[model samples]
Target: MRPEGIRLLPWLIGAVDLVMIALATVLAIRLRITLPIFSAAGDVLENTALASVFFLGTWLVLLVYSGAYEPHVFGAGTEEFKLVVNASFFTAALVATMAYLMQYPLSRGFFVLYFPLGVIALLVGRLLSRRVIQRLRSAGHFNEKVLLVGTPGYIGEIHTVLARESWLGYDVMGCLVPRDYAGLEVTSAGVPVLGLSEDVRAVVDEVSPDVVFFTAGAVSSSTQLRRLAWDLEDHAHVQIIVAPNVTDVSSERVRIRPVAGLPLMHLGRSRSQLATNDAKRAFDVIGSLTVLALTWPLLVVMMLWIKVHDGGPVLFRQTRVGRQGVEFTCLKLRSMAIDAEDRLTELEARDHVLFKSADDPRVTRPGRFIRRFSLDELPQLWNVVRGEMSLVGPRPPLPTEVEQYEDDMLRRLNVMPGMTGLWQVSGRSDLSWEDTVRLDLYYVDNWSMVQDLLILARTVTAVLGSRGAY
Candidate 1:
């Protein structure tokens, strides 16, 4: 069941937008009036008050028209932020056009400041609001009652994802399995089977679900699915979503097209195929240089501390498989004793692929502290700058680990390895070998510049929290 306040989400978002827009307007006006940086500040406060009111209303109207306040776009994904950006640009263009045509005396400096400030303010507010919504969803509020319609196997897959990502706010009320499994109490994923696909209408009416998801094998044909949608047209409040068979693909790589009156999904080339390697390389160089410039002192201090802790080498270099199955020396701070390699064979591996231990006997006193916060990996910045690694990609695999890779698993070697990637931010040493491969492969296939930046941002939080770190 959803909270009563969940219904007011759109209004709440609009209210937040209004406050941000007003804040931006006030700040822009103040900056323009007080700061002498801009030479052309005409009618700073005379007509500005009246114009600010008009601009705020226009901005809100453009945002609403751009579908920025739509319910589906809220609390998830980048669509809301993208829409806000587009609306801000649209608002700026519209106001500028109006001012030009009417010959209105608007301050040029304020006009320049307002739109950018508004975008930043709006995005920040939306981000904070999303955090609140995620917390609420985790607490079992703002949940959308979901009824699944598919075979037992398909239903299980969908249910697993919903259960894993509770922040999506989909509460699986029950599922409708195939007719053969109608007698069963529940599917393997533990979704209670309500009825067969034929009983969808009655079952939806009985459950009064907010959403009815048609997973793969839910119906025999497109005609049957279309008919199901038509039959449920009477229930206007219910949203019918069809989950295509595709999985592990980002939305950026998929698009829907009408091919001969049939809705067809077209898959675009992966990031590697898009020839973004040069851009990625430039970004890595620039990013690594900046990070090194800022953190060199800290790196030096840690190096000395590690060296002083045990009169051993400050750096540890290991041979790891990189892009195209090449070998590279991956650099890291020596977090383990000099004789740690000798003791490896004596200890049983906790993680099958990565061979990580939560409490290893080989870790030095200072090693534990640095390892937990990922300071040990800071030396890899030089490797990144040297082009042996990327700022963001899959985790580098040792030679022994790469030797065990299956043909499909070897696809991870298509991109340069990274100091930290999806595996690091997700669960680090806590993730299963299978999950680690899954996340690494996902990152390899679906990488973007924005995705890299997001991973870097999340990496900070993950390192600070020290979750799943040994």
Candidate 2:
């Protein structure tokens, strides 16, 4: 059963979106009037207001049809925002086509301003609304009670994920296992086993849960699972979720096509192919140039500071592995003493894979400060501009580190190395080698432009908190 509050959430969001759309229209009109380039003849206020109502109604209908108001997408994921943007663009295009067909003199300026502004306003409103909803759910409001129907291992895995991601709004009530298990509770994860899977309907009636999640490899057969779903449909208001045993692959890469009453799931090509795509290369160049333009003054100051501190090279360059096992000169501000490399053997063990010491005597006082805040990374923007690295990717491995990598680990070299990446934002030096490899490989497998933007946003917080930085 969906939470009663959740049922009302879509209606509430629709109302809020309507208001935001109207506000965006008004702002667009005002902007047009103030800027002579967009000025037009006619009663601007009256015409614009009439246009706003028509566009607002049409946009709302599109949003509904596009699944922008779906409960599952409400407080999490980028799907809801993506739907809103798609709906807004489609609505704008439709409006333009209608105006042309009907021969109505609609202000070109109004729409030119409205399309981007409307989508932006709606996105902002939705973001704020999601924050409020997440806060409420975190405090034990609007959460669906879930009962797990799976093997012990599957139940444990699902429970761990749900527990870690509370914003997903699932509160695990308990689990139901095979009858052969004599225990009344799951000792491994502490969730009570409500009853055996054979008595699922009886257990459902007893527990009255809102959701029943069936993990892969749990049920005996699809027919049995289908029968259970059909039987429960008549008895309870329960939503069934089935995990398909797929991992590290996103929904966007999976295409479900039904042919001859059979559903076929087709997986797309690896995202590593995108590393060489023209669009990603363009983004790297543009993003790097923009950042360099904005931060040149700070770059100059850092360069001068490093020079004054040691009277040495302002920039430190090292040979690092790039995409496809290529080598490149990775640049950074010189944050250590001139003889820091010579002292490495005396200060620490040589057996480590990714080597760093917490209180290495080679690091000067200024070096410590710069490394903490990642000021040393600014020089890498030049590498990004030169196309040797991206603004975001797995960290470039040193030659020795790459030499030690196993076959699977070399997959990280499929994409260009980065100035900042999952490893950088997740935990610089504090993360274990295993975790670092996991994150880097995950990035390689599931790279998306949106993920890159999100990582870049999180990087600021990570640098400021300095939780795992050394």
Highest-scoring model, lDDT: 1
Report the lDDT tens digits of candidate 2 across residue range 1-470: 56788788999999899989989988998887788776464677677777788988999999999999988889875788889989998998999999999987788887799889998899879877876887788888889999898888778888987886687789999988876675667638888888877677998888888888998655788787888787798755688888877766766678989988667778887788776678888998998889889988988888888788879898889999999998999988888899988877787563558988787778776778888888888888889888889989998999999999999899999999988888887678887787788789878887888778767866887798776776
lDDT of 1 by residue, 1-470 (tens): 33467678989999999999999989998999888788755667777788888899999898899998887898776678889989999999999999999999888888998899999899878877886887799889888999999999999999988987798899999999777776998888888989999888999889899999999999988898888898899998788999999888877888999999899999977676432368888988999999999999999899999999989999999998988888999999999999998988978976476788887999998899889999999989999998899888899999999888898799898888888888987779888898889888888778877677667866886899898999
In candidate 2, where is summed lDDT lowest over 10 consecutive residues?
Answer: 178-187
Model 2 pairs in collision: 1-210
Checking candidate 1 for backbone clashes, the offending pairs are none
Q: Which stretches in model 1 have alpha-carbon errors above 4 Å?
A: 1-3, 26-36, 40-49
Prediction 1 TM-score vs. true: 0.92
Scored by CA lDDT, what does every candidate get? Answer: 0.87, 0.84
